[model samples]
Target: MSIEVRSLSKRYGRTWAVRNLSFEVQPGRVTGFLGPNGAGKSTTMRSIVGLDRPTSGEALIGGKRYAQQPAPLREVGTLLDAKSAHRSRRAVDHLRTVAATHGISRARIEEVIGITGLESVATRRAGAFSLGMAQRLGIAVALLGDPHTLILDEPVNGLDPEGVTWIRELLGSLAAEGRTVFLSSHLLAELALVAEQVVIIGRGELIADAPIAALTAETERVRVRTGQLEQLLRLLAADGVQATSLTPDTADIVGLPVDDMARRAAASGIVLLEIAPIHRTLEEAYSELTREAVEYRAGLTEQDAS
Candidate 1:
């Protein structure tokens, strides 16, 4: 199954949460839905699963709107909010209740409980469960119908390191099985590890939609270290290449390949100690991309202010 959001828009009173956003999430891959706080990630996901109606355009699963499906849960499972379940209900009872509505058997519910690692807490009231447990329960509920597509919002919000790894492996396996997996999270590094494609939005507008490799390749830099760093810097400056001095002997050069830098240095009689490309991490890439789009930004410290 594939998800397509075409010219989708959402509004809350006078504010537009998502405006003219469009993207395609292909099957057999994990697509990371990324944005800064209040950038409308949740709003877009909610609209996709029919929890919130779009103000304009459409969000379709397999070329049809979510509500048009006769068996919605069996087609697309969603974990929009971890706490959407009744707090007083036991974990097992909660899944069973949701399954009953779809006529899903109890055996399938148990399988999902085990799949989500919620077997130990199956009989516990949701209110008494920790946030991590609650997240697991929510995932179990989403997987109850054995859906072909999964949409999750901040699925790792309160997980421990082990639980985080577990979720990562599980998502990868699901996508390997040719299921469509779309998720949003604040953990950019973790997203980089799992997501093959990324869809980034800023201020409710589409900013970037591309493969992870392509996005990171756009920010690649060459790091050069030499005793003649100043001479190399001057040479690079004259060539219109952007460079940043990291240390007295090391400089980071952008818009220039490592081999080209080394050749230039050798031509200038500048002996090179080290030269290599520095690949930007997903966190760095995200910070740079959304720097201007962030809704809330922290102020500089007192020392910096001084």
Candidate 2:
């Protein structure tokens, strides 16, 4: 299944929560939906699953609106809230209740319980379950239908380290089976590890929608350490190449690969001790992408922490 968000927008009275956003989540891949706080990520996800009606445009699954699906859960499984189960219901009973409406077999429910590692807490009441257990239960619910598309929001919000690793691998395997997995999380590093494509929105608008490799590649730079750092920087400035000094003996150059930098240095008679590409982490890339779009600004800085 494929997800298509075409010109999607949502409004809350006088405030516009989302505005003219557009992106697609392809099948057989994991796509990360990212945004700063109050950037309308929740609103978009809600619109996608028909929980909230959009003020304009549409959110579609396989070219049809979610409401058009015969068995919505089986077509697009969602985990919008971990606390969605009835408070007094046993975890296993809750799964059965949900599955009953969709005609899911008891065997399938049991299989999903094992798949989400909820077999240990299968009979526990949801009211007494910890947040992590609730998350697992919610995942079990999403998987009960064997859906083709998985739309999960903050799926690892309360998971332990092991649970986190397990969910990461599970998502990868699901996409490998040609499922469409669209998820939102604040865990940028983990998203970078699992998601092949990223759709980032900011201030209720589409900011970037690209492959992870392409975004990180756009930010790649070269670090050159040399006794003649100053001279090389001066030459780069004269030649219209941008470079920033990171240390007394090293300068970071952008817009040029390491081989190109080495060639330039050799042509200029600059002695270099080290020259290597600096790859930006997904966190760094996200910070840069959403810097101007964050609604809440913090007073604390790195200097203050240091």
For this target, which candidate reaches the highest TM-score against the unseen true structure? 1
| Residue-by-residue lDDT tens digits, candidate 2, 50-134 | 9999999999999899999999878888999999899999999999999999999999999999999988889989989988899
> Could you tell me the lDDT of residue 164 within candidate 2?
96
Error of 1 at 87 (Å): 1.8
TM-score of 2: 0.89
**Per-candidate local distance difference test:** 0.89, 0.89
lDDT of 1 by residue, 206-282 (tens): 98999888878764599888999999899888778898899999988898778888888899899999999999787
- Give per-residue lDDT, candidate 1, residue 15: 90
How far out, in Å, is residue 86 in model 2?
2.2
